[model samples]
Target: MIGDIHGCAKALRSMIQELAPTKEDELIFLGDYVDRGPDSRDVVEQLIDLQSVCKVIPLRGNHEWMLQSVVSRGMDDSMWLRSGGRATVTSYGGSVRKIPEEHMAFFESLLACYQTESEIFVHAMYDPSCEVATQDDELTYWTHLPPSLPAPHHSGKRVFVGHTPQPDGEVLRQSHLVCMDTYCFGGGYLSAMDLETETVLQVDRHGHVRRVPVERFAMLLKGCVHWFRSRDS
Candidate 1:
């Protein structure tokens, strides 16, 4: 799974090279593919091209939602424009109209969330009390993870999300949830994780790749304790 890519195309390209993903690997992107950095158009173009190589599931982030509202729905553009949309516009040669039809389709087709047997992937928070299928847009694309950890979801599947930028450029991992937005557009790294191995690969705009270890045991034990206590109570 990959974190938010906020238009850092060089970092995205570097991370993709580092992963060397093939047709066998499924790449899930927690979106924010446009805005706030150089090359938003290139980022979207790269993502569109990636679909031909492997299975790519792209979830919609709040930024995408804002852009859609402005472009497709013809709502006010000022809010989005102020919040990184200007960079996206500039990326498309200083006008949203210049955004290609294919790229617009890519944005419009983004999913709210994706679920597998053991994992749930969303662009942002998932309400623990609700089924993943029924999660609202506010939670799925807008809400940031609370400062305090949320309760485990009823489904018990691990949730992977991006949106809450980790300023320190680290993946925030808990037993049930992981946040991979490493704030790449703001002098941080773009993060990607191997779900099966819990291995993280981060790439910076300068094309630097770093491997980070996930502290699995400690988080797992903590979650186990919480689960047991909750069951007992």
Candidate 2:
């Protein structure tokens, strides 16, 4: 599974090349695929191409939700642009007048959440009190994980999320929940984790691979808590 891409197409391509995944290796993307970086257009294009050959599970992040609202509900672009939609607009030849039909379809088709017997993948936090089937957009896309969350959700499935950036540029794990968004658009790395093996591979914006002890990822909750507090303060 990979983290929030945020339009870092080069880093995304680099990670995909390094993984060299076959059809049997399902790629679950944790969302925020567009906005904030230079090539939202090309990023989504590559993802669409990858989908034709490999199994890909794409979730809806808050950014995608904003775009979807603007396009489908006739919401204004000001909010989206304020939140980095300008880069996305620029990606499509400096116009927010229209986005390709295919890209709109891609955004519309994204799931709120996906799950297996042992784990759940969401773009953001999930309400532990509700069944995964009953989760809504507020919980699935807009909510960031609080630093106080120290354990897995009540369902016991390992929950994986994105949206919140990790200051240390590492995958943050707390009990059974993990956050993989390392803020690739903010000069951080794009992270991909192999669930079956618990291995993580990261690629920076320049396409350089970065290796860190996988064990350290399991202890990232401390760093995450610190970062969260600092940001909020």
Candidate 3:
């Protein structure tokens, strides 16, 4: 599974080359494919191309919701543009109105959530009090799960989420819940994880690939904590 791309198309392409999954291998993108970077158009275009070769499930993120609001509800562009929407607009040749019909459809057709017996793939959060079928799109696309929510959630499925960017810039796993959004647009790496093997590969904006082991992740976390503490001191 891949984390929130946030418009780093080059990094996404480089990671895809590294993984080199065959036609039988399924790729699940956690969404937020656009915004905050320069290549939102390229990002979506590459994803569209990938669908012809492999199974790709793209879930909707809060940014996509914002885009939907602007495109469908006639919501003011300012709301979306203020939150990295401008970059998307620029990617489309400096006009949101000029965004292609196909790209708009791509955003509109994003799934709210995807589930297998072992894991639930979602862009943001899920309601622990209700079944997925009973949950609303609002919760699926917008809700950021709080720290108090138990892992495995209410469905007893390991949940993989991507809306929350980790401060340590590493994949955050708490019990069965995993968050892979590593703040790629904010001077961090774009991450991917092999769900079956628990292996993680990350590529930065500069195309530097780093394989993260459990111990490496622990050290990254410790460094982030110490950096914060030193700043506070």
Measured by lDDT, the strongest candidate is: 1
How are the candidates ranked when ordered by TM-score, highest leading? Answer: 1, 2, 3
Residue 49 lDDT, candidate 3, scale 0-100: 86
Candidates ranked by lDDT: 1, 2, 3
TM-score of 2: 0.88
For 162-220, candidate 1 gives per-residue lDDT tens digits of 99999899899999999999999999999888888887888987778764343565688
| Per-residue lDDT of model 2, residues 129-199, tens digit only | 78766877787878887878735578899999999899889889766889999988898889998998778
Residue pairs clashing in model 1 are none
C-alpha lDDT values of all predictions: 0.89, 0.87, 0.86
User: What is the TM-score of candidate 3?
Assistant: 0.87
Question: Ten consecutive residues with minimal summed lDDT in candidate 1?
Answer: 209-218
lDDT of 3: 0.86
Clashes of each: 0, 0, 0
Off by over 4 Å in 3: 149-151, 212-233
Which model is ahead, 1 or 2, in terms of TM-score?
Answer: 1
TM-score of each model, paired residue for residue: 0.89, 0.88, 0.87
lDDT of 3 by residue, 154-209 (tens): 76788898888886788888777898999888878899999888888898876677
lDDT of the structure predicted as candidate 1: 0.89
